[model samples]
Target: MITGLRYLNHSDALFTGKVPHQLGSLTNLQYLDLSWHYNRPPYRNVDNIDWLSNLSSLQYLDMSGINLTKVDIFNAITKLSSLSVLHLSNCNLKSIPVVLPYVNLTYLSTIDISENDVSSMIPNWLLGMHNLVSYNGISTDISKLIRDLSGCARYSLQRLKFHNNLLHGKLPDGLAMFSNLTELHAYNNFLSGCIPESIGSLSSSLMYLYLANNRLEDPIPEAVGELSELVVLDLSFNPLGGLISNSHFAKMTKLEAIFLSSSSVTVNMSSDWTPHFQLKNIRMGSCVLGPEFPTWLKAQRNKCLMQAFQLLYLTGFGTYLLKLST
Candidate 1:
């Protein structure tokens, strides 16, 4: 089984009694997916580590739905230095292993340790990744967590997800260092403070930004409006006041960008901050616009006729404000 054997997916298959300790003999395996790719439960070998040591060539490990909460699993798994991807979603974990150190994962890419009990400060070991991507599925202290991952700037990751947790505190300045980030998902947390202004320097490659369901206050920085190619931006269910005055989406035109599929959008604010551009169908709710909605959306020009109208509206508003000052 060590010569030509490749993958072993026993998700739905029954291994009976205990997790087979003999299957770990495959030393040349590269990708080992045990997550029921199409919804399959793995071999019922819940938490047996006797044979996993034989997987020296194992790079990608998917042990989801295994009910493996050994806590010491990573201590043994870290022996596989070639590991790149590790998915442990929905595992019955109460917290991340702090006593263990994952020094061997130098080339690791993504990590999904979600649906567990990691309800505290993220381990500093996570910052060791030089090429880490996604760090989703955490359900504990977050303010300090973001601060810890700030040290992992050498990798320039693209995705960071930490939603549905009781995370409180201000967003960190470390995010500015993630210039290469493409998506950041931190919804359903207890976060507060204004959205950082440094986000203006983020890479244009960013396609998704989910910051809904938090206590983030203040205005949505105008810098966000600069993301000319931004597609999905959700910041719903937050108590962000003074942010309604400016629609941070003022510069997206799509430049002949065509959409061939349906899309989903989430908003957590109390206002409709749409830029005066096009008429793409949108679902806006829970917005704090109260009963009187903003006029920027209705004034946007589909062609060019309404362009003058929008400008005229802005000009009139400015003039009225100037008159009040005089």
Candidate 2:
């Protein structure tokens, strides 16, 4: 008859043993977080979360850092019709549940199952979760995953992260469908090919974009300038080529940080071109930064002081760029 349990957060509590089955008695519980042991394996492992089904009113559940490799996690949680947010990140899961088409998780707003060992293609049922807003499924085949996401959850997906995965192939053109998308992080993957020009379609809502440490090649897309709301743009450590002049960043007036280090990009711009944006951090090491010191650095002195700068190759002229203001 216990109906008033509402919140429980035992994250990092260092408690050992299995999750108590008695918790299922708290039918009114709304939020429960038992995250533990991130650097190492969790001390506790649950064979089944079948007890969770009894908590019909559960809206938020986070079992991150717990071992659920042997459990059918999806089947257990799908029964919680009121669930709005679910976080099972860093769990030792081997695969995503095969969801049936008839099953509907329409109320789920966010799902983070990142850092797992999931090796299967994203289940089709996931796409039916039309209310999904944010998803982080890191360490998977990027191309197939993005393709599936673009096809299924394009309209409702806003924040997507699949960093440090086995992602390859060009950035999909279908990404342009996410008009409501605000942030995208696919860094540290094996993604290659040019940045798709279709990404400009998200200019109105997109803010943060990171695709660093990939095999992406070709010139920076001119459409990138259309992202007027961009705050941080990192395309560093890639084989990106072609001239990246002021025109490429003409409309990125809100840009705060730009990272393009260790790339084959050439920054060909006028020495006196005063940029509209004031940057806080700019890393363009091993890049071609012109025959003369970039005059835009002077304009950033008063409005935004350069916090960090690392220039590995400043053209063959061997002349140090403009002295940055403290």
Model 1, 62-155: lDDT tens per residue?
A: 8776667653677777787888888887766667766564467787788888877665556656667767877765746565566666677434
Candidate 1: residue 267 lDDT (0-100): 25
Model 2 residue 288 CA deviation (Å) reads: 1.8
Looking at candidate 1, what is the lDDT of residue 156? 62
Indicate which candidate wins on lDDT: 2
Q: Top model by TM-score, which number?
A: 2
Q: Lowest summed lDDT over 10 consecutive residues: which window, candidate 2?
A: 316-325
- Residues 62-87, candidate 2, lDDT per residue (tens digit)? 99888897778888887888998999
lDDT of 1: 0.62
Q: In model 2, where do residues sit more than 4 Å from their true spots?
A: 1-3, 101-104, 138-143, 302-326
**RMSD values, in order shown:** 9.3, 3.5
Candidate 1 lDDT trough over 10 residues, lowest sum: 255-264
Alpha-carbon local distance difference test for all models: 0.62, 0.79
lDDT of 2 at 218: 81
